[model samples]
Target chain A: MAQQTNNFSNWISQQIEADTTFTLSDAVRSPSRSRLAEGIFPTRKDEEWRYTPLGQILESSPDMDSRSAVTPEFINKLKDAMPQAHTLVFINGQYSENFSDNQTHLENAGLRISRFSQLNSTQLQMVEETILNAALTDDNIFQHITLGLAQNGLFIELAQNVDTQTTLHIIHISSAQGDTSFTNPVQVVRCGENSHLKMVEQFTSLGQAAVITVPASYIQMDKGAGLVHYKIGIENNETNHVSNTSVRVAESGTYQSHQYLLGSKLTRSNLEVSFTGPDGHAVLRGIYLGDENQHLDMRTYMDHAHPHCSSDQHFRGILNGHARGVFNGMVLVRKDAQKTDAQQTNKNLLLSRDARVDTKPQLEIFADDVKCAHGATIGELDPDALFYLQSRGIGKKDAALMLTRAFAAEISQEIELISLQDYLQDKIAASLNEIVNASI
Target chain B: MLSIKNLQVSVEDKPILKGLNLEVKAGEIHAIMGPNGSGKSTLAHVLSGREGYRVDAGTAYYKGLNLLEMAPEIRAREGMFLAFQYPIEIPGVNNTSFLKKALNEIRKHNGEEELDAIDFLSLIKKQMNLVEMKENLLRRPVNQGFSGGEKKRNEILQMAVLNPTLAILDETDSGLDIDALRIVAGGVNKLRSADNAFVVITHYQRLLDYIVPDFVHVLSDGQIIKSGTKELALELEERGYDWLVDKAETQA
Candidate 1:
């Protein structure tokens, strides 16, 4: 069994050796190289990755194949679906200048914007330092793999007291053509004191071939800064997505993350937030839909390290057609973190008898004065409710779709951007209809 | 017009309705009164096509169509409605949205254009006055956290909005107070016409006072043992059910 496990990692290493394009940047070349050589892929024995099978992802890689290109028209089609924002496009892990817009205008307004390759040597050093600091606390192997494999990524910074009224949209499109491929895209964001920024990260694939995406985001917020981050991952059926997201908040800072997972054969997302200063607040909300033998997992960790900090986590999921889901949330209050208030709730609705969910919400408090609560529930759609809607003359499928949409509406309604909220609501409705119709 | 002959129904392999027969015509209000385990609600469930009810032998005809052969929504679209004794509480679906979907689906089945938001609101606002239901209830989730009277009133509100040809009230007045019963009955009365009909099921004679049924039927062991004009309800109330059960057994 152990030898069988080693086979997949050895195959990955061999594939990495055969690919010349996969190289580390000059700033942290040696460290990233050693990290890559350390074999970041975890086996089933690892507690955090026990439920997710890594061998399936390893066996699907086409490391020796060439990267497929995307056209400008394809990017424009994607941009038209999103709300008005500064759009940044990346194809197969590399920034595409031909498809992106508004970089110069944003830079002129004191908003630092650049691709990883566009950054100067000093900027590269800063990125390396940030990666090192984040590595100290992040035990996720996917994050290190992203650090080792990512060639270019979007980097943004806001000056003190500067607010970008418009959102920053990042679209990552992966095209593997007929070959299996992998893409690692990283993003680093810094918000200065009293500044505010809203960003949307969208991941999509264009080809029929299998693709593996290891995406990571590292965000730092200074005193009184605020950041609203939303991520929508709608990959193809043959794709695997592993996302690692971390946010650090300073004194009186605020961070909110809205994650919507719609499609992927297998997806795993890890979101972590830590309060390093007093009076920091974090709101984490997510809703996911799983269909057709898919496996979706979400893990969240909230750390309250200072006094007078608060965090709330709300996650809901709908699974149908033999799909499976997992939600594990933990909120920890340190010894010195008094007056810490943390709340977490996870609810799941399964549409079929075969559909299943495993959810656990844990709260750990070491502080003397703190309030923490967590709850989780898994249930199927109420037959009485379905019959009620059907008796009102709504079709069986339509009734089910309406209930699923209502279940997802709680999370989508929290979006501050009205247009984005409407856009996501439509997507959710369409996807639910498709899932219900297909089952019939 | 509705007709049933030798209808026998079972739930979980246990028979509930055994060889029951009844007929209801347009412009008629039929009140079905019986004791607690008399399968009053079972008739309502069987008519609405609720799951888990197996018809061992029966033929129910609604406008020359086989009612039991259709799905629940089809039965609803075919102008059949059931006001549940216990209305379901859906926590996230808005009341207005739920009603509009139901209304439009029924209209579409009848080859009529669906009502837009503005038109639907206008129509619902008028019906809301009949039930004396507050407008704020439309903004909340369907029956979620609603009081018992509010839930029953909401059911009547739905019946008014749908305007089905055949409406079955299954113990709708059980949890209602006297004023609420008057309002709910008034709403049902307002919707009455020569082209539509109602089947009012109740355990007490008080609801019949407001609705004023044209015919009253006593159900026992899933069969209509005794049926008469409106005075039968008054007699059943005056003498209680023991006298009727003994009479039914003696006649059998």
Candidate 2:
């Protein structure tokens, strides 16, 4: 076990040195290495990871080699998929400056988009203080790995009161040639006071090779700021993804996270949102679809530390074949956090007999005046509803697809961006089609 | 044209329909009314190929096809429709999309060209008016959060859109008010034609008053004990099911 732990750190240290395309100051590097050494990889014995066994994944460690270039063909495919958004392409976790678009317009709008390696000393200090300091926790070894080993990533900062009209689309692609490689990319976002910004992160793989992606994002929303964020992971079927998202919301600030997981052999996403001031609000929504031998696990923690703050968390999962899913959501209201309103709901649909799901919605409210409600449900498609549709000339397969689509639509309906919503709808349909075809 | 002979059905080993027999020709409206536990629902579900019911004996023929041999959707494609007693609320399936798909599936099965979006919208709009369903209901999920009256109306609207040759309405008037009942029956009355038939199953004579049945059959303990014309419904309403139960028992 100790030897395995050493290998993880030694591998990360090697990557950090070999990939110098993006530069990081020693101030940012030394602490991340110490933090990575502070913890070991978690196992099923860990309460939060009980449903997802990671023995096989940790055994197959990935190599972090030289950065790859984003091909024009890949850029064209992404443009065809999402034509309206301002796109930023990343190949093997290294930012591709040549392929990115809409930089001038974004710059004029008071949005500073730079590579993480390009940060000056003062900027690096700010990142070290804001993100690296807060993101490294005891249970999140992957987050430590991401911050410590990542080569190059995007750093976005919005000026105070500036509203970004166009959404910034960040596309992270793992090249097929990078077989058994690690792509640990970290993104830092700071929305200034009363500012507004929307961004989407897409994790995809270009080839059939298996890869391990460890991406971490830290977002800080200033007073009255509003930030809409989406993280979509549709990597290769053999890929294993672990993403960590930590958010801090100031007074009256709004933070919304929309995450959809469709591919990958194993996926674990951790989202933690903390309200620093009163009357802040946060909304976290996720929909995960797993098929074949996929294992999907998502954990969410919402902390209402200030009075009159409100938070809502909802997650739905659809598992088929031999797939398994786990959703553990916790909402906490401190003793002085009175008048806090928090609602959490987790619903899962198991399409095959072998498919399984474990959902736990936990709420710990120390404030007596707070109104918090949480619910969790796991079941197959409603037989009665299926019969109702079948009675109207819809085939059994078509009826099942409709019900599956309906189940997913609950999460999709809350998406604020039409283009992202449309893209997700197609993904949901394709997943449902695969499920139906497999059953037949 | 439909015919059933000695149909025996059971649910989970509990017999619900025993030696049930009935017949209905095209252009005629047949109303099956009876007391509780008379297997009216089971008959409707069995005809529509619901999953649970098992036909232990006998056969049902619809237009020379073995009705029991086909699946639910196949039965629907063969022009058979059943308005559920408890309409399910499918949260995200829009009423318009559900109806359009159903209409197209039926049309495709009949070797007729499927209607385009414009024609489908027009057809559904006309049928929606027939059932007095508001246009907004079309945008909402199928029967989701719909009032009792609205769900029944939606079911009738589907019947109108699909134009089934034989429609079996199972307790469609159970939860409806008098006004909703009138609108639902009015829609059914308009769909009556020489090329199609209706089998309206109910527990009361009230629904029969609007959609005047050409023949009325009283089902008791899974079998039809009596048959008469429209006047029989009124007689049963006045005398109650007990009088007929005693008469049928003494005769048996």
Candidate 3:
């Protein structure tokens, strides 16, 4: 495992030297940059990353940014199906105007979606002089250097009382003629007071053995305003992508985020949503499926900073083969945050004896008047239930699928968006398809 | 028909059944009334192949096949049913789906075609009337948040749908009220047939009042100490299990 992770990092760094879009300044070439890179790939020393050994994943893994050389047909299909979101296309971490437009809905007033490196000094000052600076710091040593060396991503904002629906799709296609490389793209979203917005960001890699590191933050959502952010990271075994999400929910406002992690060799996502308002609420929902030796780690913190605010966190995963999964949901209710209602639940199903899951549903409450509950369970298929199904004529594989589906059905029921819910159901069907076909 | 020969069982390293034995032919309703700690429910669990209880000695044959040789589900598929004394509650798992899978598993095991959604729904509706169970209970998860009486009725409802040939009702009448007892007993009576058998394990004679037994026996100390007609239950009901315990003690 150590050798595999070493080989993967070496291959990724070499690809960086060869790729034009992955260019980095001298600041990005330090030991600190490599340390931040370590945060994405877990080490044996990390507690939350216990079950999934990042070393093992890197050993046999492909590059994280090895997306395919695009075909015209693929481009056409993407343009047709892509929602009219404030779309931003990033090809190997470089802007692609042929697939983007900044003049989106409600963005004419104090809103800009462009390359981060292209921002003026005033914009750079705004990025420096912001409340997000406290929470979005590069705590991981390597991430600090990467942030210093990185350039060019996305910058979005929602002016006070301005309602907008901008869909941003970051299509990351790997170069056809190169080794698997790495690209750290940082995107920021801000919503002013009394404003409303919905954004969907998607990341996909096309090719074999590509690795991409996404270190991004959204200083979005203001008092009396609402934001719904959806992130769908779907990459094949050819890529290992890691993303960090920091969300800020203001008083009387709402921040909702959903993550669908279905692809990647080794995927680690750190999501932190802080409810710093009276009566503010944050909802974090995610679904991650791991097959083979695929490892997906999720560490979330729903910090209630203000009184009467609430947060709901739910993450469920399915593991097959020797696949491993980790979910650490921390619901922290600070002192004086009375009347707060916080709930966190993480459930997993291990399809094989070798499949493993480590889930810690943690709740830290200092307020006595608050209500918080957390639960986590890891178990194999119920034998009596399985026997009950098989005796009725269902095949063993079908029976296993039924049990796993039943476990995840409760979470799927929570998705209010019909199309998204339908999409998830279809994905689950595809997972079971192999089971049915395997019998033949 | 079910037959047990020199059946011996133990639970948690404690011997419960020591060379105990009984037989029930098709169409026969055999009632086994035992004193406390007499291994009656243990026999039911062991017969159904429930985990934990180990069979130290004995061979149980259900229609010439080794009953203990099969898994719990295969035994269920093979027409052997054990209505648990305390039915397990599984929330988030629907009653309709659980029963459908169970029925279909038995069908599939018998090499029958699997029922589609429409057919399965209609079959569930038909069985709902047989047990007088509300269609709503069938919609909920198995035994989840159900009242005591409702749980018993649901168990009988499953039995009606699965159509088991040999049912060992292990004190299904304990938690039920009088009305619930009547409804459940009525369902069991309706399912009784010339080709099916029953072993009703109970403490009180009240359950026998609803579904009268063909034969009654007093089980004491892991073995049947006395056997007689249905009249024995009435006598024992008039005189508690202590009288039988004393008789067994004197005989020993």
Candidate 4:
């Protein structure tokens, strides 16, 4: 296992070294390159990765030369979810200008959305500073790999007090036909003082593409600002997705995030949020539905470094057909962060006997005056609940579907966007229907 | 409308219902009075096809069809409704949608066209009024966070909407105040028709005051020990069940 970890790190380092077209600045690349050169990758022995095995990700070599095309109809269907938003498409980690919307109107409205390659010197410096200032306590090798090898991503900035009504929807499509593809997209989002921004990022793949996606994102919310971010991952079953996101909220600011992981052979999402000033708030909600040997892992770290800050997290998982899910969450209240209110909850449903879930919710409160609570639950559908519905004339399968959909609706309904919420609920129901039918 | 012959049941090899028998025809309302641990709930559960209950012997026939052979849903579609004593609180399933689905499923089984949203809303609104249910309860999840009275009222509301042929009320008056009991019994009376029958199971004679039963049966040790007219309930309420239990034991 140790040798395999070393080989995976070495392979990533070699990929970085061989790419002559690495366009990121030296400041961004050198630290990640040196870190990769250290060749210390995580194994099952590591506490943070005890439940997730990276064997499938390590064995498949990423083919950088392979490129496939996405049909316009498929892109249009994705766009229909957020039709009024500013849509940006990424194919194989490279921004597709032909498919993306023109952002001149947004630029005129003091909202800046630029590709990393097109960022000016000032904006690039801001991106670099945000990455450097992120409060990520459990930074792993995948983040460094993304920083060193990232080819293209967006750099979005909202001016002070500019609460744009239009959302920014970023769609990443991996279209690799024969060989396994690799993509590392680094996103930087900065919301100025008193600004509000809503962004939805969707990751999907074409056909049964073998893709490895290691993406990193850094977000900064200024005083009194608010950011609502949503991520939906619906990649092919042969794909491996590993992503890290770090966020910092200033005084009176709010950061809300919702993630839906519905597909992928293996997925590991690491999210960290810290309150840099007093009176900040964070709300996190997510759902991971896996079926048929899929492995989905979610890790979250909430740091209450300022007083009067509150964080609430609720995540759920539904697994079937030998699927496995893991939720490892930690909420840390610093000594000086008095009167902090932090709550973390995780609930999982295992539909089949072979399906499994490992949930651990932890809270470390150094502050004497704080309200901190964490809970984890794993169980099957309540037979009483099922019979209640069945006795009402609903078929057994339909009753099961209704109950499962209700389980997901608790989280999906929290999404503020109506269209996106409907889209996700439909996807969840479709996937659950397939699982129920197959199991029956 | 319903018939049971020597219906014996056990849970985990422990007998709960030992040779229970009952017969009901259209338009008849029969009240089964029993003490606690007398297999009252077991009979209700067994009739509804709940799991964990073994039917040791006997058969339940509904309209000349084998009721025990059908799934719970099939039994329901065949116009059998069981109003639970303690309604299951199902979070996330909206009450309105659940009722709509149930009603439509039954309608489809009867070769009738399904109700659209507008028609369903109208139908449910009427039923809601019949049970005096709060309008907000329709939007909430099924029975979640509901008061005991409200849950029972919701069950009556469902019974009214479903309009089952053979409706079994399993101690629906257990958790209700007098006023709630009056309203619930009133709702059941409103829905009573010549084409339908009811089996009201309760331990108290108070509910019988509101919805008077045509016949009263004393159930003891899983079997109906005494059968009499509605005056028998008042007699038992005045004299208590010990005299009857003692008489039945002496006869046995």
Question: Which candidate number maximizes lDDT?
Answer: 4
Put down candidate 4 lDDT per residue, A335-386, tens digits, no spaces: 9999999999999999999999999898898999999888999999999999
lDDT of 3 at A173: 53
For model 2, the stretches where C-alpha displacement exceeds 4 angstroms are: A1-10, A13-28, A64-70, A132-138
Clashing pairs in 2: none
Kindly report which residue stretches of model 1 are placed more than 4 angstroms away from their true locations once superposed: A1-32, A64-69, A120-126, A135-138, B249-252
**Interface RMSD list for the candidates:** 0.7, 0.6, 3.7, 0.5
- TM (chain A) per model: 0.93, 0.94, 0.83, 0.97
DockQ winner between candidates 3 and 4: 4
lDDT of 4: 0.92
In order, the Cα lDDT scores of the candidates are 0.86, 0.87, 0.72, 0.92
Q: Is candidate 3 or candidate 4 better by lDDT?
A: 4
DockQ of each: 0.76, 0.89, 0.24, 0.92
lDDT of 3: 0.72
Native-referenced Cα lDDT, model 1: 0.86
Query: Clashing pairs in model 4?
Result: none
**After superposing candidate 3, which stretches have Cα over 4 Å from the reference?**
A1-67, A70-134, A141-151, A155-178, A192-207, A317-321, A348-362, A366-368, A378-399, A426-440, B249-252
| Per-residue accuracy of model 2 over A72-125 as CA lDDT, tens digit each | 987787666567888998877667778888587788889988876678877776
Residue B79 lDDT in candidate 4: 95
